[model samples]
Target: MADPVPALVATGVAHTFGETRALDGVSLTVGARERVALLGRNGSGKTTLLRVASTQLRPDAGRVEVAGADVVGQPDVVRRHLGVVFQSPALDPALTAREALRLQAALVRIDRAEVAGRVADALADAGLADRAGDRVGTFSGGMVRRLDLARGLLHRPTLALLDEPTTGLDVLARDAFWAALDRRRADGAQVVATHAMDEAARCDRVVIVDAGRVVADGTPDALTSALGPDALWLDTDDADALAATLRGEGHDARAVVDRVLVVSPSARDLVAPFYARPDVRALSIQPPTLADVFAAVVGGRGGR
Candidate 1:
């Protein structure tokens, strides 16, 4: 079979603001039906890249295509084929949820007769159908975010770009947002920019960016595996003493907190010996998490 065309593509993309280089030679491609998480620290150019891909901002150098149309040269064509949910709330306070979606459909030149049905579908898809007639200003932050998503889907674009879509949401709200994306991915492609490790793990693939460059890219499991082995966390009154003892016994151990010692993955096989010690208390082994993988990639504790 022929290789599927990319739904979104960026090549040698570079952007600068004053003296700071926001993006430097960054490139990425998302295949049809692919779900990719763009993981990065603050100011890593993830948002800049998303803006370029969505045709909201033009890159200083390089090519960006959304569903095969050049973002710079054919912005309107690209916009018509892409949906964007920005970090900020884009809904107007005065407009009702249904009205907001209606306005989006009209602005996108969706068929007048089809606008109502499309707006209804979009609201339902975002799980905001019950609030369709409520004004946006009265909605909670999560509700407002959902409305933004509903508006973005008004045109049924082939590619969806979500910039920190779950920011500021509580755990329940965040889960709801992910569930909506899960449903959308069942039928199309999505590129999510997120700092939440758990959220990043939900994507089919994750690309880690730091200092305006791609540092790691892979499935969550693959990235975590590179960190060596599962980590063991032990909380004890004498964490330093325990670490010294473990080190003396040839176990790779380091103190993460005054009372907590994080041991190397290899220590799992040797944990029984430590657990048997009367002085050690509260010892547990955890599988490598995306945060651990991110820390290994970015060379420090992962940022929010």
Candidate 2:
């Protein structure tokens, strides 16, 4: 049988803003019911790609399809099968929880007869049923985020796009949000843009992007396993310099943020020499992480 259609597809998508190239020839596909994370640091074009897929911003080149509908040519049809949870809270404090959901149902053009039932179900699903009549101003940050998600999914879209949904959420709030999302998105494909390494690790697949290009794509374990069994992190004053020195000596070393990482099957054996350097303040060895994998991909592409 032929392969099933993917929930989302972006082919050679490019978008620019003035002089900034937010997305450049980026292509990705999210399978049915798959949870994929667009992993990248800030300014890496993950969000830009999400906007294009959502039809909020048309690409300067190429095209995006959501559930078989072109985002630019058939935006209304694409929107019907797509839900978006933005990083920013788009709720009004004066409105009650029920009121907010009711408004969302209207915006999505749900049947007027079904609006009431859907709103109640959404409030209950978000764990805000008891607060349905309460004004949004009284809700906590977590509650607001959950409500936003409920609103986005009110129409039961086939694809959900989440843009750093837990950007400013606290540990407990983030956990709660994930728990709620887990229960709701069981049957749909999800494409979430996030900078959190831990969050990317939780997804079924991770697509690492840098400078508006995809550097790597794979399952979390598959990606990290490629770096070997263990990783040695050398905390140094000048990580770039240390990484250069280690690389010159024929080691798989790369600078990752504030640390220089060296990966191998036996990282313990490689630690002694680096630990003795005056600039190396501390050193630790652990299993390879998504961050380490990301750094390796970016480094191979000639980036820090």
Candidate 3:
């Protein structure tokens, strides 16, 4: 038998905003029930790709399909199969939690008979059944985010496109949102655009984008493994300068955020020079992580 179609597919997708090329020849595929992270720093085209895949923005070049429906040619069809939760809150402050979901169901054209049942299920799934009659404005940031996620699921889409769904949420709130999302979307595929390394680490696959291009794609462990077994970290006053110095000396080193990271097979042996440096404040060694892989791939720029 022939293979089943993927939940999402993008080929040579390119999009430009004026002079800034947001997505440059990007391509990727998400299998059924797979959770893939569109991992990148800000301005890395993660959101652009999501928008294109969701059919909110057409690409300048290339093609995108959601559940075999062409995003451009059959955008309405794609919309039916896609559940999108954007970074911004779409809830109305004056509307009650139940009202918000009811509106969403109407907007999506859910049958009147099913709307009540679906709304009830959504409210319960969001843990907002008790607050169904309460105004959305009265809810916390986490509650509002959860409602938004619930709204996205009214259609039971085949693919979920999440663009930094927990951007301003606290750690606990972020965890709760993911739990709710996991419970609701377990049977569907997910493409989440986020800059959080920890979030990307939890995904089945990570597609790292930089400068509108896909720099790397692999499982988090597999991607980090390419950096070798160990990573040496150097805390210095001038991470960029120290990174440049190390690079000049032929070390595969780069400055990530506030530290200079060196990934090599013999990570311990290369730490002596930094350990003796007056400007170097601390030194440590650990297994390679996604951040280290990002530093190496993006050339030390755009740290999480």
Candidate 4:
């Protein structure tokens, strides 16, 4: 038997804004029921890629398939399989939560008879039932995002494209947002674009983009396990002596402030002997972190 069709497929996708190459031959896939997080710096092409896959913007090159429908030639069919929540706020300020949801259902061509029920269920799922009649303009940032997500799900699309969905949410609101997302895990596949590592940690896999190319892609544990920029740290008043001693011991060690950092693959072998020293104040091993992976892959500029 042939392999089943993937939930989403983008191959050699490329796009440009004037001379700036927004997406350059990028490719990705999300399997059924899988959650993939797209992470990168401020202008690293995450948004452009999402826009292309969601069928909101046509790419200059390559192909995208959403639920086995072509994004370029069968855009309407692709829309039937996609629900996107953009980074920017796109809700109308004047419409109440209920009114906005009703409009969304109509826009998505939901049956008129089912629109009311679907809207009610979406709002309730988003925890907006108590404030269904309130204008969206009066809601907090988190509340607005929740309502936006509710509108996205009203049509029951098979693939969800979320771009920075929890960028500015507070702790409690962020938790609520993830709770809503968790409820949909068994129903469809999700492609979440985010900067929060904690959120990425919850995803089944992560794909990091930079300069319009995919720099790294893997599960969090898998990426973290790969040997990289891993460091063995040593703290002591005699930083120079420690560095010299480690070098004499054939370890590539360097001093930063009052500590020596060892980055070689053999750093772990020195742990036992270092702790045996009387002057060794403290020792800690930092496994390769997601940030470290980003830095190593994306030109050493870390964070987000």
Best by TM-score: 2
Model 4, position 266, has a per-residue lDDT of 67
Measured by lDDT, the strongest candidate is 3
Instruction: Give all candidates' CA lDDT scores.
Output: 0.81, 0.88, 0.89, 0.84
lDDT rank, highest first?
3, 2, 4, 1
TM-score of each: 0.82, 0.91, 0.91, 0.83
Q: 1-304 in candidate 1: lDDT tens per residue? A: 9886789988999988888888888888898889899998788889989988987778999999887899988988888888889899788999999999888988989999998888888899888889889999999887788778777767767898999988999999888777776767655689999888988999889999876677888998888876567766676777678777778877766654444445465757757976887877768777778876665456433332
**Candidate 4 global CA lDDT score:** 0.84
At residue 44, candidate 3 shows an lDDT of: 90
Clashing pairs in 2: none
- In model 1, residue pairs whose N, Cα or C atoms come closer than 3 Å (at least 3 residues apart or on different chains), thus clashing, are none
Each model's total of backbone clashes: 0, 0, 0, 0
Model 4 agreement with the true structure over 89-140: per-residue lDDT tens digits: 6789899999999988888899999988998898899999999999999999
State the lDDT of candidate 2 residue by residue for 66-180, as single tens digits. Answer: 8899999999999899989999978889999999999989898999999999899888888999999999999999999999989888888889999999988899989888877
lDDT score of residue 92 within candidate 4: 98
